[model samples]
Target: MEIVPIDTPSLGDRSYVVHDGEVAFVVDPQRDIDRVLAVLRDRGARLTDVFETHVHNDYVTGGLALARATGAAYHVNAADPVSFERSPVKAGDLVEAGEAMRVRAVATPGHTFTHLVYLVESAGEPPAVFTGGSLLYGSVGRPDLLGSEHTRELAHAQYASANRLAAELPEETWVFPTHGFGSFCASAPSAASSSTIWRERQLNPVLTRSEQSYVDEPFDAYPAYYDHVAQLNLAGPGAPDLSFPRRAGTTELRRRIVAGEWVVDLRHRAAFAAGHVTGTLNFGIDGEFATYLGWLLPWGTPVTLLGETREQVARAQRELARIGIDRPAAAATGRPGTWTAGPISSFPTARFADLARAWQHRPVAIVDVRRDQEWRAEHVAGAVHIPLHELPGRLGEVPGGEAWVHCNSGYRSSIGASLLAAAGRRVVTVDDLFERAAPAGLDVVSRQVMA
Candidate 1:
């Protein structure tokens, strides 16, 4: 038996292909299934089944599409309130695939009420379980991700569910989870990609914490896009529309901008800061584009692409697809020279040293667009904290002054600076190391280490 981990690094999610010689089964596929098919081809195995741990809230699932393409049975929780047809799987149900590969469904409801973990073993080999967004490598999946009302009930369920997995599964049983790393779905990040049941038992605090305290895990804020994703998944967001968006001409692109369509500029930070189409969002093609772009783009809002090449635009679309962000209204390639009527707008960018020297003479509002954890670790004493994803909606919170934006890295700060500029604010980006805050003559504030 062979189990392969297919990673979607942008979202920090992993799907798997477990096969025994001739037949294979896919777990929690992303919307783009070409790689999954390619893996099958490489292994010379026929895909016979597709398993969904739950109706995912993070991204669109490619289970239905894969099943349809490969003529495989799609398996999901029997209790889920999804509209699409799926082979209902219940706890303790054993399923057979290929000559020796066998799967046992273990319902684990901490992550989602209908979540399941599949334990796959073949011909007396030790079992490996696919724990999708349930029990991760270090910390377990967050319970409050669903909502406030369901948080208490689901937190208790998650505790019991975790303890059950530890008690029932053998120590040597291999564990594979879909969320960890940088995924917001995880309670905390893990150092490793995969772990054994024994390792998780020894390290994970969720299994050891009191139910009440664990339930009280304070959630700062979830992405606004998350509010709409669950409903779309429940309604069975079938397959992404196969038709590619049309290429927009200069006239057409300008019209879309006038129509209030978001134009995502996928150039690098330096290039974007140097010059870009005014009001176009600067989530570069080279950075953590998927997560932030998915978080920031309002649901069902039409988007157009402004990139350097057709491949660049298509590459952006590919990353967006992993997060269920399809339906790009149109794409406009190349630099703004031919695509826009007005000259490209450029913003002033500063390194920490220059920012420091200027801060002594003029009080510039420092905007830090990192996550809550990053902010708590260390930040410039009086810097305003609005995460890049939240900046579009919460622009009012920023103080009125000459604004200088910076995240841990320059990438996010550049994006934030662009947004601030587009909103008619006077902004410049501190496009350098965040640690330079102190040397730059700013009072550095440090908070408690994240749990």
Candidate 2:
């Protein structure tokens, strides 16, 4: 038996290819199906089944596409009522692959009401489980995805479902989860691709916590387009051609940058800050670049890139393509003076302690770039609240001073700081202000007074 995990960096999603001898099955396939087909062909395995652990909210799945291409049976949870060419898989439903591999559907509906986890039972080895959004490495899926009321019910169900799995599965059985550390599906770091049930039983915080705490803990905020992306996934996405634009020379790249076209520097943050095309947004190609790009930039915006090299640019293009944002007009060659105008500057970063001390001496304005809910919940004393999305238009509201900026995390702060700095305001980012402020009792400033 062979299990291959395919990590799609753009969406922070993982797809699986499980095969035994001549038969193969794919689980939660992303929009790219050719790679899966190529792998199966290389191994001389016949594609037999494509399974969707749950309907995704981040990227489109290729279940239907792979089914149409290879004439394999497509399976989705029976309770979902999803409108696709899928065979409804309920609890106890069995799927066989050749003479050696078998899968049993277990209804696990905490992430969504219709989610399922597959229990893989091979001919001679211990059974392994594929827990989709229901169970993750460190955290469980946010129950609030379906709405507050439904979330409560789902949370209870999820806790019960998890308990059921823990009891039924053996300690040594390998657990292959759908999403890991970097994925927005769960807050836990998905650095490890797979883990054993024993490890999760011992280390997974959410799984060990009481049911009430598991449900009530504040899950991180999701991007605004999550529902829209979910609809796309349910509808299924067509295969992308994956053919991006040719890399242009330094002059042409600079010309495009001058014409107000956005250049996304996909290099590491340090490499980008050291030297990048002027006015380029440094959304490092590491974590959730595609998701953030959709939030930060307008849809259908013409974009060039500053990758480590031409090959890196091509990889970045593929990452962008997963989210249906594939307009790679050109690539910058990292030549100095190529981009001469349009905010040739970088945002400043500072420690929260330093900003707090500076605030005591002078009237330095603090800009909280977190979401409206988060701002209302807790923010720094005397800080002006402007959500990152609304900051571009409300710049005039920001009082001129040595500005200090912060978000729930540093990503939005960097973006906000960049824009403010570009507009000629001195800016400094407060790294880890939320964690620091909360314990110090400085986070709970009066909202009424601020308003």
Candidate 3:
């Protein structure tokens, strides 16, 4: 028996394919099931079971279609309000995979009411538990995603869930959780990906802290897309639509933009800022493209992708499909000469060092377009704290001066600078890592800003 980890880097999600010679089970798959299918094919294994820990709030799950395609029994929480038929499993239920592997459902509710952790017992190996969101490496999943009113109740439940798992499982059991590695679902940032039950009990802040302190712990602001993802996941997300987008001429692209659809330029940030089609936004495919695009895009609204090459746009479409943003109504990919029409726009970018030097000669107001939790942790002494999502509505709050904008790694600040430029605001973009500013002679301030 062996377990393989498949990392979906865009969403920081990890799915597993646990196999025992010929039979296998897939756990918490992402919307794109191709990777799981490929793994199964490579191993010459038959997929017999598809399992989900909960109704996910960050991205759609492809378990239903994967089960349908492979004739596997789909297992999910019985209490979840999903429309599709599934083999509902509750606590204490054991699922047999093959001669050497089995899965045991353990009710561990905190991230959601119906959450479950699966304990896997395989031949010749120590027992390991798929903890899901209940117990993570350094921290646990946040409990308030269901609603703000459930914060205290869910936090208390989380405490109970952690204790229950620790008592039920042996200290040598391997702990695997789905919500940690660079994901917003975690209550605290994670330092590692995998841990043992004994190590987690010794080092996990969520388990060691007092119940009230853990409950009162602040959480980062969830993206607006999370609300949409929750509803779609519960209703059973549709299969990925792999059709190529209709290549838009200049006219159709303009029509879509005029009709309130956005033109997303998926080029590199530097190329995008140098010159792009006016009114289009930049969500470069270099880093976590799907996650950021899913967060910013309006649900069901049409979007046209503009990239420097055809392959770039196609790669972006594949990434977007994982988050259920498929079938882009129009796409344009070519050198700027073949594609863009009318006046192209550009924004001036400055380095943190340059901005710091200029700040001494003149008082500048920097726009820190990061999440509130990030801003509160550390920021420039007098930077404005408007998150990237709220930039449009709160544009007026940015005081007029030598305005400079930046995010942690400069991805979001590029978007913020474009929006401000489109709104006729003259601002210099600090297109550099915000954390690197301290060594570059910029004064940094830190605080425990509760979300």
Candidate 4:
């Protein structure tokens, strides 16, 4: 028996392709079915089953499309209200894939109301459980994604569900989870790349803490794009069209920008800051390009991609498709100078020391655009707290002056700087690591100081 894990690092999730030599099954695939298909082809395996732990609140699922392509039976929880035809599975249902693999659907209602973990048993191999969001390596999936009304109930359920798994599963059982590897779906991040039921029992707060304590854990805002993904999943998303968009010229790029459409530059942040087409926003294709772009860009707005190469544009297109932002309206491949005849706009990129020096000389507006939890942990003294997702709507709240924008890393600050610059505010992106802020002599304060 072989289990291959495919990771989508930008979204911080993993999909599994498990096969007992000839027959293979998949769990929690992303919208790009091509990757999963390639894996199956490489193994010379035939796909027999596809399983979804829940109606995902993150990326659009590729289950329906993969099933149709490979003639595999798609298994979704019986309780989920999905439009597409699926082999509805419930608790205690046993599914067989050839003679070597036996999968049992165990209902684990924590990540969502209908989440299930698929327990796979094969002869000589250790038993492996695909614990979708119920029991993560260290923390369970956050319970607030559904809504506030369900948060409390789901939080309590999450605790019970985790305990249930720990109590029933053997110590050596391999625990595989779909969330908690930097996904917002997780209540917190897990440093472990892999874990076992024994490791989880020793380290996971969910198993060790009281039910009331687990329920009281706090959550922050998730990506705005999350509001649309679940609906798209319920409606049954098909395979993404990853073909290159129509070529866009200088005139078209200008017109789109003037019309308030998103014209995203897919270059490195440093290159973007050095020089970029006027009015184009920077979402460097090298970083978390799709996540922040999908998080900030108004849904359904036409987007035109500008990349340094055709390959960059194609890569960006594939990333966007995972989150259901299909077929970017247009694209161009070249340097910023080639995109516009007008003067290329440029911004100053700096370190925390630059910011500190400027602050000492004169008062400057510091916008801390990290999340609420990050802000509460530690922040520069006098920095205004405005999470990046909220910045587009709260522009007026920023003090009228030059704005120094930053996040934990410089990638997000570049995005924040671009938005501020586009809105006609003078902005400088602090492109250095946040760890340098204190060493650079900036007045940093902790949550205890604020309290």
Q: What is candidate 3's lDDT per residue for 406-427, written digit by digit as tens? A: 9998888888887777667777
Model 1 lDDT per residue over 1-451, tens place: 9899999877778999988768999999887888899999999999989999988777778888888888999898889888888788899898898778889999899888888999988777888988998888877787888878898888889888888898889999999999886677888877796789998898888777787888877755556666566767677666666455688888887777777678889988888888887778788888878777778877778888888888888888888776677778898888878678887888888988888777788888889999887887888777899988889899988889889999987988988898888787888898898888778777787775223
Query: Which residue pairs in model 4 clash with each other?
Result: none
- Alpha-carbon RMSD to native, per candidate: 2.2, 4.6, 2.1, 0.9
| Angstrom error at residue 242, model 4 | 0.6
lDDT of all predictions, in order shown? 0.83, 0.75, 0.83, 0.92
Residues 1-451, candidate 4: write the lDDT tens digits.
Answer: 8999999888889999999779999999999989999999999999999999998887999999999999999999888999989999999999998789999999888779888999999999899999998899898998899999999999988898999999999999999999888888999888899999999999998888889978888889899899899999998999998888999999999999999999999999899989988788999988888889999999999999999999999999999998889989999999988899899888899999999999999879999999999999999999999999998899889898889999998999999888888888888999988889999999999889889
TM-scores across all candidates?
0.94, 0.80, 0.95, 0.99
Task: State the lDDT at 76 in candidate 1.
Answer: 80
Alpha-carbon deviation at 321 in model 2, angstroms: 2.6
For candidate 1, give the lDDT of residue 327.
72
Shift in Å, residue 103, candidate 4: 0.2
Model 2 clashing residue pairs (backbone): 180-190, 181-189, 181-190
> On lDDT, who's better, 2 or 3?
3
Put down candidate 2 lDDT per residue, 71-149, tens digits, no spaces.
9998987777566667888888999877898898998888888888999988778788888887787666666776677
Q: What is the RMSD of candidate 3?
A: 2.1
Instruction: Decide which is better by TM-score, 2 or 3.
Output: 3
Candidate 1, superposed: residue stretches over 4 Å from native: 208-210, 242-244, 448-451
Provide the global lDDT of candidate 2 against the true structure. 0.75
Candidate 3 lands at a TM-score of 0.95
Candidate no. 1 TM-score: 0.94
